[model samples]
Target: MLDVEKSVLYVAFGSLAEITIDQFRELAMGLENSGVHFLWVMRIPFEDEFLNEFEERVKGRGVLVKNQWVDQVEILRHGSVSGLMSHCGWNSVLESICESVPLLGFPITADQYWNARMVEDYYGVGVKVLTDTGSVRGFFSSECIANKVKELMNVECVKGKEIRENVKKLKGRGAAARSAMEEGGSSWDALDMFIDQLIFGKKKK
Candidate 1:
């Protein structure tokens, strides 16, 4: 289903989010209305009546993975995945960064709010889906959800282009950081210094 290049939007809210059925329905309808191809990782069982109808409605345009363990990294790395709708968990944020995929932040709790803010305000690599109110667990209408998805996925838009460029640069930095952690690089040297301090009770001069 994720065969077309840069055409799939990957949606996952992480495992800890406590989303209501109504909210899930809103998300489902929003994705269906967005007209963008998507792969949704649903925590709820597929046997649920609402999901069964949603799957049938979006059969050709979406793939729903329900109540199962999925290799999220593999999905993000796929050529077809262009954008991520995430709960902004630290791990998910880093995975999206390493893959160079831009995010549509839907943060739930803890450090996720900060992560979402950084993604949008600090890094310029993503957008946040704001609620009508200022509450942490505020609800959003299906229309708002659809609009945000369209804004992120519409490559022809200026914001979309900017996000793409920002993510590209970030990906380069991530590659450099990975290289720096290898045997003889700067990160390796720093780690060695810390380990030496721990063992010898003396800081490197």
Candidate 2:
């Protein structure tokens, strides 16, 4: 990652999420075409020959981790990692915000859609891969992935610059959150009160 010139894109979906082989192929090709350095943590259990060939084709430009665990937070915190290709799970979103890594969200299901919307629309710290109809749901082709990946990774572009700026600001909020959990802070006081109540029961007014 240190050897990469600009910054590496880190890719991961949550543990249980799954995509069809076709979707996986499109995603892989899209990442390859985007012309960015990427590290993809592939957890989907599928036996496909294309996976090997794809890895060979990408070579130094991309790396795919098969059936393994990587420290996502550590990767986001690394200096060389500029963006995340994520499922937009709440935890992943929070981790990216805390680490100040911009997101390129490909939401799968459930709360992921809402989280992705918040990251892209509410916070402006990231972009969601959109379908042909401009909806985040529905089918995403290789072209869509390529465009969104390029959009998020290209800091010189207006939208990308805005996303990066937003992320920088959100990083400050993340710091404030950490401080609030520390001694003498509001979160700390709240926790202390809760613990006291749990231990001794609430006193009558």
Candidate 3:
């Protein structure tokens, strides 16, 4: 039931419901072409949404959506899942960052743009299908998706190595951010510092 031998390629398909047909095709084509692979959650997940296809679709396209991760932590820790294709959701980003998988980003919204920026800009660990079209739902041909995935797959020296190193750093950042919320953590330190600044600034007035 749990087999990590064949590399995992987690594709979060439903999240891209709003994307045009061409965009959807490219996404599927990209996953089909990514060279990285994934097994359906059924192979691993005991209770996956795929078992109920009718509820997931939006006008025949899945809406409540393609959540391609684990609820239990051990599933990932146990030599399963290798890579991810995601729409840059907050939890998705956090899970992928923590999972240490090479990711192909497809940001679909505002916060996603920020998440993608962190993955592409700060971490250097993920690749974005960089586009410069004027509109929101930018036109991207299937060929573009295939080519980008090919390029991402071919990244070996600089792109690959740099991304690998940076992903580790991102994990540290994620850890620290999470730690801050815990008691007596760096998060409180920053809050305390901010309060001190406000107190001093007000006193000067």
* lDDT (tens digit, per residue) of candidate 1 on 21-55: 78888889989999999999879833577778889
Candidate 2 at residue 190, lDDT?
81
Q: What is the alpha-carbon lDDT of model 3 when measured against the actual structure?
A: 0.54
Of 2 and 3, which scores higher on TM-score? 2
lDDT of 3 at 100: 67
Model 3 TM: 0.59
For every candidate, C-alpha RMSD to the true structure in Å: 4.5, 4.2, 8.2
What do the candidate models score in CA lDDT, each in turn? 0.86, 0.86, 0.54
Residue 198 Cα positional deviation in candidate 1, in Å, after optimal superposition: 19
- Candidate 3: tens digits of C-alpha lDDT, residues 1-205: 2354525545562333355544654555544554443432312222445334323332222122245544522433346455455677765666666666666676777677677667776767777666646222356555566555554544364676666667677777767655664567765666677787787864211
lDDT of 1 at 45: 31
lDDT of 2 by residue, 79-197 (tens): 78999999998778878888899999998888888888898889999999988898888778999999999999998999999999998888779887656757986777887888888
Q: Where in model 3 is the C-alpha error above 4 Å?
A: 1-6, 13-17, 39-78, 132-137, 151-157, 178-205
Candidate 2, run of 10 with poorest lDDT: 1-10
My TM-score estimates for the predictions, one after another, are 0.83, 0.85, 0.59
Error of 2 at 150 (Å): 0.3
For candidate 3, give the lDDT of residue 87: 71
Superposed Cα deviation of residue 69, candidate 3 (Å): 8.5
